[model samples]
Target: MKTVYFVVLLLVALTYFTTIEASAIPHCSPWRCQQECLFKNFMKGECIQLQCVCSQKIGGIRP
Candidate 1:
């Protein structure tokens, strides 16, 4: 009975965490771009053709 309870509790915890929505760092770029991107709440910070690009936040798993 105790073993069964532990399994059920773990499952519930995993399900609850998985359902939570969050953002992740999909792209990592240069120092300058990264600073600006995170400061502005952008998800992606990259140097595209020698230009710094700040994209909107994308949904994923991030702490």
Candidate 2:
């Protein structure tokens, strides 16, 4: 009887877990893009594209 109860409980847990995997995959780049946009403030734009871009500005400009 105890073994039967354990099997039923395991089935319920497995069913619930299947639903989780279905929703967990990365579907598109749009979601990734938005997440990346939020972190833009942390990175310097020049360091990304140019080979010799510096983090420091000549006159402390915001841009």
Candidate 3:
């Protein structure tokens, strides 16, 4: 009976710790693509596929 109680307590502790870790996990933004680009600092940005991409292509390349 004592061993069973200990096992149950251990399981509860593990579950609590798992939930805490899961909540502490870092979340990523879906709009990672819309972030600042390297070139054309003056250019504007638009959301595409949940990412921030340059509204206008710079030097025939997408910024």
Candidate 4:
């Protein structure tokens, strides 16, 4: 009985810690990426693989 209780408590603690760690990770959304790119003067922006990817016209030409 004591071992079962300890196991349950350990599982709960592990779950709580994992949730905190997951929430600590940064999130990059498509809209947020676009806004960030626009702020930086980029023509296009997207979130790819949890990262913000920005692109601009080449040689001052609009595309």
RMSD of each: 13.4, 10.1, 8.5, 6.6
lDDT of each: 0.75, 0.52, 0.63, 0.86
Provide TM-scores for the models. Answer: 0.39, 0.36, 0.38, 0.51
Model 1 lDDT, full chain set: 0.75
Ranking by TM-score: 4, 1, 3, 2
lDDT of 4 at 38: 85
Model 3 RMSD to the real structure? 8.5
Candidate 1 ranges with C-alpha deviation above 4 Å = 1-29, 58-63
Give the per-residue lDDT of model 3 (tens digit) for 1-63: 999999999999999988988668654343443355434552456655644556655556465
Across 5-47, the per-residue lDDT of candidate 2 in tens digits comes to 9999999999888888856853434444444544553233232
- The 10 consecutive residues of candidate 4 with the worst lDDT sum are 54-63
Q: For residue 43, give model 4's deviation from the true position in Å.
A: 1.1
Candidate no. 3 TM-score: 0.38
* Residue 48 of model 1, lDDT score: 82
Q: Select the stronger candidate by TM-score from 2 and 4.
A: 4
Cα displacement (Å) at residue 24, model 1: 34
Q: How far is candidate 2 from the true structure (C-alpha RMSD, Å)?
A: 10.1
Query: lDDT (0-100) at residue 34 of candidate 3?
Result: 39
